[model samples]
Target chain A: MSDKTSRRTPGPVYVGLDMGSSRSKVVVIDEAGKLLGHAVKKSGTDFSRTAKACLDSALEMAGAEFDDIAGAMSTGYGRSNVGFVTEESKTEIGCLAKGGYHHFPEAITIIDIGGQDNKIIKLDAAGHRLNFKMNRKCAAGTGAFLEEMSARLDVSLEEMNHLARDAREMIKLGSYCTVFSATEVLESIRNGKNVNDIVKGIFYSMIRRVLEMDSLTERVVMTGGVVAHNAYLVEMVDEMIGRPVLLAEYPQLMGAVGAALYARDENQSAGATTAQASSKGE
Target chain B: MAAGKSTTRKKIQATDLMNQVMSDYFYHLNEAATSGKQKVAWCTSVGPAELLRALGFAVHFPENHAAMLGATRMSTELIPEANSAGYSPDICSYLTADIGAWMKNITPLSKAYPGIESVPKPDVLVYNTNQCRDVQDWFSWYSKELGVPAIGISSPKNVVEVTEGHIDDVARQIEALIPTLEAISGNKLDMQRLRETVTLSRECSELWKKVLETATATPAPLTFFDGTIHMGPAVCLRGTQEAIDYYRVLLAELQGRVEAGVAAVDDESLRIYWEGMPVWGRLRQNSDLFAGLRTSVLASTYCSSWIFPSFDADNPIRSMAKAYLELFIVRSDAYKERYIKGMLEKYRIDGIIYHDAKTCPYNSNSRYGLPQRVEADTGIPCLVLSGDLNDLRCVSDEQTKTNIEAFVEQLQERQ
Candidate 1:
């Protein structure tokens, strides 16, 4: 909101704020692209609440105050209102592509799994972001879907991931959507297949769909809230694609990181411009 | 407009007056049929049977004829029949009355048409449901009553896409029905008749498709509603030579205009893609509104059914049932995705009009996320049109017209 570009103190940090459909995440990254702090809160975006509760919880965890932040970046479902800087918001695709680049410098493919949609972004080997594809316009093959299946199987999220990781044989899970996958998981249960293996098959099926979309995928990296919680997903994805995936240390915080980086750039420019004008006037 | 409003202002009540009148008329006609009700014909929607008669059939539309007699005017007089038939509050009022009338063989109006007894009964029931699916069951019910297997023709379901494979399959299914027709009607369908029917259906369909394609032209030469109703004969009388004829006439008129470079919606700028089921009850009204705004619906998933609805010309008889079953709506969502993508590409749809029908769940699946995908894929702005697929109460003309006006304005500006 400030027009004056003033130099920031050495300890000043920029923060990225992301409000997803299912949860909210934030990250503080200082200059030099080093992540300083990150935090998340499970909260629904009841717009009237203005995300005040989620923000407070995140700030307390990061030990960062409102003033210490020179500027803040925002992205995700609620990026338009993150209130850190006046910069216009980028699309989810743009944010994800930037996140993928920052996380894996050589990454050519980005797989973002969320509650309602599966997006497989394909980038040329040089990381120019060639093309991308999504699922059948449903919230299947996303993390929220996995949570629903895990509930139907009566398995904890941790167990769901572990079981999928341990499975040797993958059955064909009909689809990645909660509607169909739950039914297929139920069918597999009736067929006397072990619960964990069914879960494994589901994870594999999702990875396969992502792989199908990212047909030209090489060095795939995944980001989302589901990644940190479902350790098995990272492992199974590696097995499914026959390669290791570099998970974001804070998988859910990439959007936040991108936002913070944007905020940092804006803050530095503002400060330099203010200094130049002051010196000229003197 | 007054005539239309006054005509529709008949009894809002649910009674059997119209049905009784219809039955009494039908009964006397049946009684008069010394030649055994020769040349019976059934109709699809509520409209004139001129097309059928133009093609040579003793035509009758139960709904239209019932609507014409004005028995819906004194519906309360037949309350006894309405209650006895268990046509309670929940069902569509017209359907209840229609069935109530069909079940009985006496009505006060039967006496009105004094010479009706001399009129012959329908020997063949030609039921078409291109506008509404309810006619399928209605005509089937009548076929049972007449103790004759009615020849009912159905149009394909509307999905976002239709494929050549789908067309081939449907043709095969239609081809396979010939023996079944021989068994049911005891009249073998000649290959010549079948060929004629397919050729007619295809030409008419192609003309209709051309009409749709021409909307891409600046100042579209024809409006969508005109096609919606004109497309009636083609869908209902698919196996007949007349449907082909009617469309051929309509096609020539359209082609002449196109040659002269007439615009359906002159100064065409706004383009839209209809999503979900079409509200048949309000079909013409809505299409007319689009035409008024110079916003042509370049493509609609609903209209796309005919795009890939024919069967493989060769070996068409073996897979008839499978073809009917493979109708995009009945198939998996994978097929639906394929169907929609094709429409987006072929029609170059600028935005989606998601009609969200009240009576149809199949067409309204995953509707919420459709705007996101459509806008992302085709870069087309999309809005979910809130209304039923057929029911009129769910249709708010004022609200609909307002939203459409806004959509067209934004779409044009963006273009």
Candidate 2:
């Protein structure tokens, strides 16, 4: 691929980094708000390094280099750790709302299940956030809880989602605590319950938790790494909420996309300021 | 040598005065027993401190001490002792910390005031049920341990209007305490002194209200964290002339900042209201987080709880009854909702952050459906943050930061 910056009008390119708890993602967007490229990787011990790697991979996918980027923004758990974010980074909830609204552009509710937390964001008709609720102090009904249950059942996280989808009967786990639910899974195994049914129960608990976080509106959007890998979870949420759930085009990269949009807005505002200064000098 | 760091946030100058006055107050309490002239009384935050003052007793509030422990992050260290004493972890943190401090023989205040090993033992314990039932039970437990008589005043709950009968019910209870107080302190209740003390308390409350009102200015001159710390005077020294004088100094400083266009949050883009008790250990962190986001938490229900608009100096007992009975935490849900609505409009609040304090059931219970109600009624968004005033275990800084940041973004979107 040839570099198009010199031949073209040198349009601004924005990069967004989402340093999530379990994984980090980065996305590159052009001046027309089109996704150029994106990449995702596990977020290891060093968030800043992982964020840099994710951005590098995304830039490579877009056939571009770091010098081609005009602005950068960051979001998610390690938002402040990103070195390239020139402007203030946004929160995960804000990014989720922005990402969902960018897709739907109407009154919508977003349910985001991440490694250690779950968030429910409500947006108005004009794509403005009205309110949001988050489950932070608990590990139950989050991606981490599902991972723990997978460990308890001696299965991989990916396999648990597949097994849960194939189950004919679903077990209903009563406890909203990860430790207690782990014990309950063991008890279910002792009672000769199917492992698939038990895994489905864990998914139900997660769906119940996200649904109970707040009141859902007409349009519902589901995003995050958990839903990105586990399509059955959105099916369960749709069945429970009694409506079809809209999935983000790049589910795991939604936060990064929202951050990219923010970067583009910042870049335009800066450009406007420079233009005004030059016009005044004239 | 590159030296001084550049800073933009304007720190409150009143903080210095607050520390000085609080230090002197604790130092005076440390010497109260050694001086041998004044008997010490342990009172609740909303209890009858004016009456205690009129009877010539130096008073201290355990709630204030618990708050100090909370702010100093010492409550978690002492909580295990309370747990060892068979108190469940689910109980009020203030109880656990206060009782745990007694069990472990630890006092954070002593570090500030030298030679003060613990809180001055009470000659008599006094509490009121206006805030919560925990105060009564907490005082009773300590009273039993110390082998001292305890007096309590119960206020009527769910009253739409605070009637004369309601005031009389609490007034009688307070009047019954005079004999016990006079007998214990060995000093008669001087009617003139009681009247004077009540007047002073009224003046103090009015000044505190004005100080809180100064946040109404753009880019609020006082943040809620500052209010939480400044509340030490109102809770510990409300009836004292020193408390009156201290607020006068504080109000002056706040007025000066407002005129000079100095802000608690630099370049504040949004103003929000905090509806519950602060996460005491993380007050500065949370305040700075909001400041970093260009959001100013201008006012709160917790700090405004001390504002008594019903004080009648002529009828001291009845007025005290009326004033204490109408505390924000003691009122019904409808009254609280209306009060919150009024505060939202008065302060031009862009959002509300409701702290769902884990151990404080009385203050935390109303937060469940109240946020949705406020959003529907006022067209203002509400974010519920699950945290504890004293227990750091229940609070997640990452979660709270994200929630508050999103709330600010929502406000910006609306703008």
Candidate 3:
């Protein structure tokens, strides 16, 4: 009885804590399936401390405290760390399914990019995702390279988008490493080629990885922090995937929202089952 | 290392080196059986240690024996046992050695040498699943060959420990194992003893997890690889007081180092993942190259294979039984993502150097675009350094070095 009391009783409100390879992520959702409020914060280098900070910040942004939250969940590389979060914490699959379903009920593919991994999930019309393909281990065409190359180019992310969108010709930089990309970018600048061309090449390379999905159907839902920041990447992915990439209104908040949705479902089911059992005259 | 001979004539030379181990083995076996103190050992996938100590009514592990054949300097000779058994030479060397040992029926009954002919043989066999699927195939053969019951802990694909349902599965497996365990130890299935063992092992494993993460902070207490081997005493001889003591010392060393801010590598310029298995022949040199860069493999899919948290203690038996379902190497795509995210979070890995192990299909075969995927998801740059995991002849030491040097330069540039 004490254990039951100590453990969180299923309640309304859910949160998503995406423990990423490069960063941490969080989101919140209220009961009746409403997005009360959401926030995005950088994940930490040290998970225990970093995740704690990310969680705290998200809670503050939601205009509440951690105690105010009725339930919580986490996903990403850091899900295990969130094992202590709640019993209802779902895997990235269920979160993405929930978020993607909420965003585009017809969405079939859900793509998420974090600091160090990328995934192309295939969802059904109900946003019920099927088997998905992911490339979290490899970094050839991921956001890390883009961020690295952007740093090397000494161009701000905003400038990168502006320049990439305006590039005259996309030079096949063929530079896989950000180190090599930097060298190539610098050399191209030294050789009097526009830095924008190299930046375009870098974005295209990352897009190539995302577009490699075998069954990338229409209604693709894109999530993760980078999705909101890099429109060029989204646009390129859209063109490359051969479909207008769907966006969650709060792409970064999807994981958290999904998590909160899970929490709400847990409470709803618990309440319904208990109501039925009590009504049965027990 | 002394070249201990195959035949009896060289026994004298081998005497001084292994006399202590042989003496202890015999003494413990006789004393335990006579005193009716049953000893069982848990298995770690990477080394021979834990299972070796558990022999004689205690469980024995072929996995560690296989690791010895893969990683030891003398891997060349002992490893062929796998190839002789028709296993691919390019497979995990440990599996080869394990398969070879199992096929030979070299249990506790098998005499260690002519000197200690009285060494009691291992009565029960235990196996650990590697992140590689081959572990399942390898152990299936062991089960068939030994005819003695073989207990296996299946690795899972899903990471969430939501329900205690896994405990139910674990309990079922443990229930089946009781009769075999009883038969081997010549003791009845004592429920109290099982509970004690489970409680102690769970405590020990939890400590190990704490110790592993303790090294992640600045001046990391130890490299993930060292911890992988050091974990030997716990996973192998767990369910005993010794395991508790061993962890205390190890944890103390780790905590001391943490307090002192003793970085595992003094000048770690970068931390990289060794994508595939090390080319067995060039293990030292390849490791050295990284050490030069202060880029220790803080966590790797391969090295972290043994570091899984068996936290679902509500049911210890099935938890142990279902343990394999979580091996990062063997899990499905979704499972791999979960592990990747955890690794990046648990260990402060800056960059990754993906090594496509030369002939190890199991180690090498992964999602083709994972490097990019990882980079995008984590925002860390990855250098896809194409090198085979184990074919020494094909990999060029110099070329690999140049690539590593360049990769480190990228990390340094970021700093």
Q: Which candidate is the best by TM-score?
A: 2
lDDT of 3 by residue, A1-282 (tens): 011112232334567676666667776566776665454555565665776776666555555556667767666555657655553334564566677777677847788775665666666554544444445335666667667777777887667787888888886766555566667777887888887787788778777666764556667778876787778778987787677887867777676677667676766788899999999987
Ranking by DockQ: 2, 1, 3
Give the per-residue lDDT of model 2 (tens digit) for B137-230.
7888898899988897987776667778888899999999998899999999888888899999999999999999999998689999889989
DockQ of 3: 0.01
- The regions of model 3 sitting more than 4 angstroms off are A1-282, B1-56, B99-121, B128-133, B136-167, B273-283, B301-314, B318-330, B354-365, B383-400
In model 2 chain A, where is the ten-residue run with the lowest total lDDT? A1-10
DockQ of each: 0.02, 0.49, 0.01
Best by DockQ: 2
Q: Compared with the true structure, what per-residue lDDT tens digits does model 1 show for residues B1-415?
A: 0001111111112113323434553554455354543344565442213223333344455544433222323223332354476644234334444555555554334465554532244555554443446566666666776776666545455533546665565445444434544443445555444444344544555655665566555555554444444444444444445555555555666666677886555455666667776655565566666655656765665554543244333423323233344555555555666667777666666666776654455567445465556556766666666665434545566446534654554454355
DockQ of 1: 0.02
Evaluation by TM-score, superior candidate among 2 and 3: 2
DockQ of 2: 0.49
TM-scores computed on chain B for all candidates: 0.63, 0.96, 0.72
lDDT of each residue in B115-199, candidate 3, tens digit only: 3322223444555443555666665665566454556444343345424575465446445555565566556754455556656
